[model samples]
Target: MIACLRLFSALCLAALLAACASSPSSSLGELPRTPDATIEQLLEQATSAKTPEHAALLRLSAADMAFQQNNPARSAQILAQVPLDSLKPAAQIFASTLTAELAMGRNQPKAALAALSHPSLQNLKELPPEQQIRTGTVHARAYEADGQTLAAARERVAMAPLLTGDAAASNHEAIWSLIAAVPGEQLQASGNPVLDGWITLAQAIKNAGTLEQQQAAIDTWRAQNPAHPAAVQLPTPLTRLKELASQPLNKIALLLPQQGPLASVAKALREGFMAAHYQAQQAGQKPPVIEVYDSSRVSSLDEFYKKAQADGVQLVIGPLEKPLVKQLSARPQLPITTLALNYSEGDQAPAQLFQFGLAAEDEAREVSRRARADGLHRAAAMVPKGEWGERVLKAFRQDWEANGGTLIGVEYVDQPVALAQQIADLFKLRQSEGRAKSLQSTVGADVAAQPSRRQDIEFIFLAVTPQQAQQIKPTLNFQYAGDVPVYATSHVFSASGDKNQYNDMNGIMFCETPWLLNTTDPLRNQVTAQWPQANGSLGRLYAMGVDAYRLAPRLGQLKALPDTRIDGLSGNLGMSPSQRIERQMPWAKFVSGQIERLPDTPR
Candidate 1:
């Protein structure tokens, strides 16, 4: 029983405890200490003992004692049974406050707020100033959790005038900050002015500080309010968020070029998606009934969407063409997540559509990230001079710049670079400097002295064919390029595994998709079984069609990544915040013309 006749309110209350308490811990660490309860304590305060006030207070005391015994469920049960009619005005307020606190302890923020709304609970004016403040402060937290920001703020403003400071003042401000839509820097001063001053002082360090400054403020806030919810328990994602299978399937339309030039490929993908429904049925999940709209069937894509929406299709996936994806996404057909098979036409990602293509730019960034991590800070590019080649070149430049690496110079070569000749041309000037300095430095030492600049050629980016990469990369073994790393794109990966053709590609890296590798998955094996016979990589695209179908309805989850992180039929993926897929270059080096991984790249 703490007495409270104070001038300032206890504005620094620690809230958000509800968010923390519900986080599931893998293990219950240990049992807490036990306490002895004396029945005599209940009898000691028996003044007008038969009254509601006396009864409610006694029940509250018993409930608290149960809570102290590590039995929260029992404590809440006891509080609920307490008779409220006999409670005096002060006792009634205390009883309701305790009710809300019990809800908080039980991790029921919504219920806690509901409990505060009780008529007896809401009539805080009849209670002592301090008790009213404590009740209102906690009630505000419930409102915040329910997404009622205005109500929470209103509660704070109304109750701030009632509190007086105590050991609990620090507890109040932490809660206030969480539910606040805007910073409470200015308004905090009006509440329990003493604690308000402390919070105001905190504002100086919290306003748009550097990363270090922000971290320090976070640490300070935690230290001052150890029990604050966000401090002790983080907002961990509940992976058990009910999966889509349990949900009613939204009508998702499939738009593919099933009747056009890629009709065979499109049909293959349609079957792959059909396989998904079969798999879902086997798993006892509701299957989505897909309505396939052949892009070749409709003269206009806008009609495809119009028909689908008229038929109640809520989602759409496919139409691999970039132009169609742009038109469909500009105005979404429904409140659905549509996935396109190409890059967004512009930087503004469509709210209704997302891109799932294996974007070339994404591969470049991955290559650059790996290069820097390998301590390859300086790079050069020998790229082709066409639409595809120039695109790869642009990707390389952007990736290098964004990653703090410098591009010394990029040479355009339409044919496979004369590996030895290009290496000689690039390094001839540096070599000439050495020859000129022969008189100043030891000739043997100069010969032994690999120029520091030579070592700076940490890596090389060559936009060429597997045959080209293979032909040129090995020539480097005897040249300066041999000492530097080499990187490329899927173009190099597309070679037909001609061992003799790629004999020189023993140590070159490139990006690839998951389908590029034949997985042990029976579906993958079955679809591409003849690939080995034809000695072709066409089966990989076949599998892409198959995998696409299985992933279609799940388009909402697949391409909708929150960051440059995505997981696709390709590899572990990155996604833009707008939920577009961002894939990486799965690096592989040629091992005897059969792709093998370098030591650092994952197998």
Candidate 2:
């Protein structure tokens, strides 16, 4: 019996050794611990790997090294060799994460998200914290690129526990920025306490009336959430905000033409600006004193600046005319910070000069971004034949081609008589008809065929007046291209409320100022009540005026924080590097002769 027991123990020992030999660490033996290991060495090792699993592990490491070396093509090649389905759970997760990183490098965030959704990521926690952090970072970036701001913040928040040192600090700040960029309407409490704390903090800052009130709100939030990440260390922007609270904007100079061609435009702007000021006073805040100056009466910008300085103007709001803005842009610096209501033609400008206006080019760029987000790659444009049309088309073409979209065709709409011909030519209906005619001639009889529009054109970018749009939409249908989507700027929308006019513009989508889309805004309602024309297209200028008021105090904040976006009445206002304010407007579609608001698209 003793001899039998000894033999049985030896057999058990042999089985245990076999299990140890096939363990994960041993099976993945020779896998590079660091990406600095030459990819060639890892690839060489992969060739002679003893097991299929070993081969995949080595190749995955080689692919990661290739990615680190910035050879995405080589990394993709090596990754393709790794058979993911047959790999261990950890290896599979690594493969998916690397695939996601590659997709992100190519600017394909949707593909990156799809790759990261591999089933093996469910076992991601089983891997090392480093691996988890890598996956989470890529996931968060993809979400951010794909315009899922809240999701990106949540991912960064989840990564907080795994990160340390500078990485942890950066991740923490990114979380705050992502949450801060979210529109106030979208800020709601998710069930997670950490995320909820962040949202509540952002809401507190957004809803507070004055700088002192904002500081108090921040203090209240930090006290309530003592252990929160942001509470422990406030975001850099919030810290800056605290510093800005000490310096208040007590006076502003509003410079606009009062008796020139722009007089009517200036009237709407002044009223909108004062309406916001009155609303702030009603809310029990010490609003700045606004002094109006007539640019038409002023002969020199230098004298205007000196006078503004003498008047204790902390900021100069405008000189709405293009010629005045061009003059301001030529200067190296200004006596006081000027927020010009018009943008200069020159690309360069003084650091102190910030430009904000209702530029049609902003909406044109929006069309390119929105079309790309909707997965359309080919576009054709139809703009009125003039300098204004040329400007809009130039903006659209630059943005479209930059995002890898093809401007397949363009038509200049000058006269109503040529509308049908222009539409047919743009869609290549003539070419289709010519081909059918050639075939019929060869067959010696007429072949029944409809002239079909080109299949390559994905959508049409329409820039026209509402009257022109009414005729063009129906003409496009007559040319057998009604099914193609039509995107337009705010110009296409007149806000005329004529159902018969809108009926012809059915199936068109346009981006317009929120001031027109949302009639319920308190300030807008009040302004419209006083100036009934504020309910029409003129409301866009009024909205721009209101935004200029909102933008004056926040210009410094926007410059300091590059990612900051103000939910303005005009649009989601953001500052470009050139100090020009850009807008991401809301979309609306004409359906059955009624305007239907579309959800905001990815920016």
In the order shown, the candidates' Cα RMSDs to the true structure are 21.1, 7.5
lDDT of 2 by residue, 88-154 (tens): 6677778889999999999999999999998878776655678879999999999999999999999
lDDT tens digits, residue span 1-603, model 1: 133523222322222333223211212111111224442455354334676544456667776677667787877777677765555444555666777777887777878876676666545564445555777777877777676654565566566545546523443444444332233334355454434433433453335223334345555666876654444532211011123323455566888886656776566556555655565678897666778777777777656666887888866768776667676656644345566766656656556666666566667766776777777778888766678778877877887886578988766665554555576666564575566578457554534344333555667887776666666676677664576778777667664766876666777777666656535555555445534521244543554555554455444333211211224455565446565666654566776667775444431
lDDT of each: 0.58, 0.89
The Cα RMSD of model 2 versus the native structure comes to 7.5
Off by over 4 Å in 1: 1-246, 259-285, 332-336, 417-421, 428-453, 530-536, 550-567, 598-603
Error of 1 at 168 (Å): 22
- Which portions of model 2 show Cα errors greater than 4 Å? 1-31, 35-38, 41-62, 83-92, 118-120, 184-191, 206-213, 255-285, 291-311, 319-337, 344-353, 364-381, 394-409, 426-461, 466-543, 554-603
- The TM-scores, one per candidate, come to 0.54, 0.70
> What value of lDDT does candidate 1 attain over all alpha carbons?
0.58
lDDT of 2 at 95: 85
